[model samples]
Target chain A: MRDEAALMRSARFRAEREQDWIKLEALVAKAERGGVQSLQFAEARDLASFYRQATTSLAIAREISLDKALLEYLEALAARAYLIVYAPQERLGGLIGRFFAASGPQAMRRSALFVAAGFLCMALGGLTGFLLYLESNDWYYVFMPSGLAAGRGPDASTEFLRSVIYDDSPAATGLGAFAAYLFSHNTRIAIFVFGLGVFACLPAILLTFYNGLIFGAFYALHVERGLGWDLGGWLSVHGVTELSAICIACGAGVQLGSAVLFPGQNTRKEALRLAGRDAVKLAIIAALMLFVAALLEGFARQLIQDAGARYLIGWGVGALWLAWFLLGGRSRR
Target chain B: MSLSRTRPTPNRQHRRNRRAARKKAASRVIPPEGVPLELPVASLGVRVAAQLTDLLITFAAAVSILILLSMLFFMYWSTVFALGALLFFFIRVPYYILSELVWNGQTLGKKLMKIKVVAHDGGSLTTHSLVLRNMMKEAEVFLPGTLLLTLDQTAPWAVWASLAWVAMAFAIPLSNPHRMRLGDMLAGTHVIRLPVPILLKDLAIEAPRAISANGQRFTFLPHQLDHYGGFELQTLEKLLRAQENRMSQSSAEQNRQAMTAIVERIRQKIGYADAVEPDDELVFLQAFYSAQRAHLEQRQLFGDRRANKFYADARPRGTG
Candidate 1:
């Protein structure tokens, strides 16, 4: 008789709760197949309530030593329900808006010290490269690759140097292609620099300095031809944005390296995780900046030949970026 | 359900214990209500398979786009090349991030593999986490992969550097219990295998009909039922369910032989003298299973909980 009673008790227990489990399972299945958007308002509310009830049933089942199969089913149901209920709800539009309005600029501001360090490294390298080139023109070949130098080396005549900067035919014919190529290439380099930052920031620093060396060498070649002022205007049209984007990318990488090297209060892993949040934001913003730079390089530099106007547009954009980074998301915070 | 307790040989018992031990380790996350839930981490092999599937899909898509663009802009080869580069990045990068975002951490490949990314802290899987993890994939997998493919063009020192980087990246996942790659560790996320829910009918209901169908009903006394516990009963329940599943003629013959062996062993353990007919083997087992389960449930209420048949010997000397 006792055996029969025990059997009946378990059977009754399952009978009482089976309906809820089946309902919850159906809801979970629908959500999995079609996402939370498929659910009606009432049905979504039902899902949450059913999830809580299932969790309670799981707890009860464990305490009372219900049949093993029933207990396992309840556990699985509860876990699935928990994941669905707690999933992030922000839409893509909202996420992108939030990033621009607050997260992106805020992250950049937070990592200013690292960005400064990155800039210092690049500037110092530029000085060293300029001085070496001044000492002797042999350093020019060491710094600039043949393909990149494009026949406008120290030996190039003044007229040739001027013609290269003032050239606008390529922009008319394939400006779109040029911009796309520059965007993709610069973005790849920026991302690569950010990624390699995991190895103690040394690689990022060296790469940034190397880039500065090439720029310095190129500038010295133009200066030798008495085209320094003209070249500055041509480059300033896009270089300000492009170089700053690279600097930001390097800073982001340095953030990761320092997080690993000196984790401070947190464990190394924890520090790296925290730093990744800000570093990713910085990296993304840097990529966007590179896109702008690419556009400027491909079109504005080609169309606008006036040196003074190019400087105005270039530094004007730079100043605007600085102000935006400083104040864009402060109100939201 | 057979009350005739089958004693597995020592070798089989050891193997079973080891199998149980090899079950995937679960990560515990505490929900808002404070109940800790165990989510099973996906195995390394499954994760690799899912990644390969995703990579193949992206590569195929990128190639198709490239071909279409080249065909449309045959006159402008440079434009086609530039567009192709942009298209590949768009397809590859957003394919991962957007798919995971929309599907709540599952891409097509992850969905096919029945795995998903979940937050380590049991919170919602935020957009930042998803993007961060996928971005790191470029560094961890794609960059090293491209380096390896272009090894002939690279300097010898570069080859060694990339090789070391790849090894370190691979070793990180292997060293961790959760098999978390660099992205997962940084993003505070890990992939988990979704459980396949089993909806078998209650085993208790199979007892009465099976017992009544046989001319000689197999019955067990209380003491005979006391030898085993809930764990053994559940294992028997699984075996019975497996037997009910349709199989080929050869497998059916093998199944019958295995059941006969179990019946013989069970009878020996319980010291039952009566011979159970061959056709009634399943019926006898079902009857024994229900009786043993009921007996275990009653003892459990009295705080004399037995985990398995081995519990009797494992108990303290005084308790036995």
Candidate 2:
């Protein structure tokens, strides 16, 4: 039989030199994992020697060896699980999340203010376009591509304008066409606003205000020309959803821009990361609204040429939108 | 014939020795696997998910806040009111509460996600930790952005430098084991996995008694030895008798002989055979030695084949 004392001496001797072996073992394990550079055969043998010495001491003392491969494999599995859980839903969530994160209370207040401002500007823009229509004594020419004016001036209201909005083609594609155009346009606008955040929202603010004023001008012109009811019914059909989307885009843009400008307690980079998240969410919601608006404007509104029917549709969409924005969303969580 | 016989004998003994060593390395005293170790810092993926979730919740929360703030701002900016009423509760309150609560605390996202917050020492988070973590947000998110926003077409060098600085600060967690952010380090708070439910009552037994390798009676706690001033042969005779009474079989008798030889060797080495009997300290030491020696002898005879070479080489020349 082997001497028990000699065995104990060997175990103790191995324990004394366990540290070098552990390092070598770790190096070899890492090299085998392919995350490290190459090693010589001598290095590999040295690592093996260290592993043997450590294993011997542990067997004598603590009675265990760590399983390096199992630990790494488990870590990798955990990382992959995280990616699955957090990544998929993030696409839309990220868009809207940024707007909320950037503004907090500010986003809500700015949105409300912008909504009111949008109404005013749209009415104003409509009014200017109406004035231009009346000046040329060509109210029906406003919607015509041929009669459209140069520069930023409003186009004359042409016969084509009213006819096209209300007309049904053989393909019956007015609703789908308008919906596609409106949805794509709104999404583009929202993204543009969000991207322009690099400029601290100078471009976004100008864009929002320009659209708002144009809308206001359009509304004012009709009201002044004794075409208030006709215009109101026409605008309300698609206007509620379309305009709501524009407002949302502006909200997202403001959020992105504000993070850059006021980053306040947050670092500018961190704030941008946050703002970017919220803006994306808002942009998606805007796209959904635009889709609904275009369907109403091109199909439902155009078919219901009766002033009263148009008025009712407009009021219904407007009320629904109002409820969505204002009193409808009450802490569902 | 001697070489063939000796070769198999040594190979069997060597295999037994190596097997014993490997088993000792894998056992941990306390089982930590099932217990939830608090997560100090989440990886990058978790951080991004949390940020995204907070944004949506904040947007809803922000609407009300923004409305009030805008009213106040409009009143002041438009000069419509004699005095501007800045309702701190509307804007600042939610901002402070939500950032600390959701971003650092329990943002709706985190609440839905099943994670929690704690100090680095594994204590409940304090108010100071919350404020400090949120306050550093400006440095984390905005200052560097201002340079990019303002100097877009000009001072490319300055913009790049500022961006690099910001990235470095954000990447600080990557370099540390704990993955602490600037605020987390300063406040000594950590985001961790919530404690999972566990039932200890389900265990049938805790810490069962140890059994001797030779099937002899064994006691974990030390006690006074009954026999005193006994010679090595006398103790072995007593142990053999006691063991015979406890176990019945030819194998038991053979194991007893092996154990006796191992114990006598240990007793001779420690120079404790001359000591008087019934020494509690000696008995305890003897018990440990007995267990170790028995295990080693069994391993030498029946363990890994490669390990027996040491003993084979140590034998007298031409012993085979």
Candidate 3:
């Protein structure tokens, strides 16, 4: 009860300063609504000074008086001012340029081991399937899912194989659905290869291998019918980007999966977070690659009949990808 | 596997935070390291709610699109169906990736929940981070959902694998201080609740004395003041404010009861002497306020605004 003089002093202080606070609050509201651009030079200066005064008032109000209303008003005002004044923004254009020109390639390079592991799985699986299918034709069915055959299983005759490959009619009905299905399937598989990499890349590696095995069985079946080069031309157009994208997706997954499994000196969560920065970049790039592959398969594959031109375009695209991965973003002195 | 214990309270979990803070303090140097700041992570419940909201929204969008497509291609039911499936799968791609991009890390659900995604390093959200996290969503969440819906009969192992993956998604966040799922972990992003702090309004009081009329303020030595830190100071400040308001209240007896409880707690906390009179609550509070304010202001000048007692004791040692 004897603290009455202190309470009077605090209330008196608030009465003296209340007008300035109301005026400043109005100014801050204007600034927030229209951005700092709405304020004149003098008004902006006044706002800054008011903010400083408000923060100081907050500190004083906290220690010297128990005026809870005044304290809260000042605290809220100060916090709002802090957020508005110190709002952080990064330049989108500059960051985008920097990321693609430097960070993306750097991340891909860092994930080389994962890419190699991915490629190794696919190549070994492909080799196994090629030999197994060459030994006997039933291995094709064993390698490929029966549901996924799309009428290319072992029962299909040599005539059917050659005719489908050469069928370049402009009027292709039901082909849109087929194209959509293929795109959906390929995208699903690519994403699948990347996603399952979280299991320390086991499932991803096996999937890449299984994909390659199916490809190998298909290749062997075509070769036995003396249409190996024709089929190569047919596939090569998009295979350049499609296959490499699969490798990239697998690599990105391995980057994440192994980071969790190993984690190096950091904790598992920390390691995964760091590796994720790289993995996401690679996965997106791989998705982009798949899109390009789909575009090529849809538009260009039907138009090109000569095996030589297909080989030229396909290998050329592959070389371009190699150059991109190796030399896209190296800074020059 | 039951995560009921780890759920977030509006106030950070007292028990977990206290233990972690203590461990952090015990391991830290006297000066502390990395600022030893405390930021609350969003709870699993809030995150799950946000996710479900997003799913409901996407489902509605897919359904609307399917209806339109079906009507447009009324003759081609199969095409309509396939396109619907494709849209269902992909509608989220633009919805999530673009919303987070344009809004700088808030999807509609996250925005509604007042939660936002921020970089793990406490930086601004980048396009790459958004893309990466959303892309990983294929594996982290959607794949499991898809497997559950389809349940491929030929691939029995796939069901178990999807279930395990989903289980890991729930399990992983429990292990870290930040409740980060796989996507969050990979994207190096975490969600934070943007709290607009609600201030507690103390009741009105008639003018009270600046200094007690009897000159009966409890005196304390510098060492006695040092016994309590900023955390206790803030608490005491709250107690004094409440008591100030209570002075004019109808329930004088209840006010006295509450004031005595607070005074007793403070006595035990700071090891104040047992010599203080029972009727001298106001005097003790007045004396402590002056002493603690002086202590804090002095520390502030030395650039040590110890926000709480935890800041005082958290000493960093070498770590793994």
lDDT tens digits, residue span A1-333, model 1: 244533545656777888888999999999989999999999999999999998888777665653777777877888898889988777889889999998899998999999988788779778888888888999998887564677988888888899988885654435545546474435555766787888899988887887788888888878877889999999899889988998899999999999999999998888999999999888888888888898888778888888999999999999988998999789743
Label model 2 with its docking quality class. incorrect
CAPRI quality of model 1? acceptable
lDDT of each: 0.81, 0.46, 0.70
Better of 1 and 2 by lDDT: 1
Model 1, C-alpha of A25: deviation from truth (Å) = 1.1
What TM-score number comes out for model 3?
0.71
Name the weakest run of 10 consecutive residues (lDDT summed) in model 2 chain A.
A80-89
Task: Supply DockQ values for each candidate.
Answer: 0.40, 0.01, 0.15
Over 4 Å off in model 1, which ranges? A1-10, A63-68, A145-147, A152-159, A171-176, A183-185, B1-24, B48-75, B143-171, B209-219, B229-231, B298-305, B312-320
How do all the candidates rank in terms of lDDT, highest first? Answer: 1, 3, 2
lDDT of 1 by residue, B78-154 (tens): 56656655566668999999999999999989999999999988889998899999988877877666666644642
**Comparing 2 and 3 on TM-score, the stronger one:** 3
Best by TM-score: 1
lDDT tens readout by residue for model 3, B245-303: 53555587877787788778767777777555666776677566655656665665565
State which candidate has the highest lDDT: 1
- Candidate 2 C-alpha lDDT tens digits along B1-320: 46565555777878877754543321111111221121324555676577567655554555566567566554233222111112221333346444443333555556566554455543344554554455444334444554455444534764785577578656876655455565455455545443222111100011122333433333422222211211332343334334425566887667656665554554555444333223232333445433333343334344312122254454468644
| Docking level for model 3 | incorrect
Q: What is the Cα-based lDDT of residue B144 in candidate 2?
A: 53
Off by over 4 Å in 3: A1-88, A91-106, A109-113, A136-138, A167-179, A261-267, A298-320, A330-333, B1-38, B58-75, B85-91, B199-320
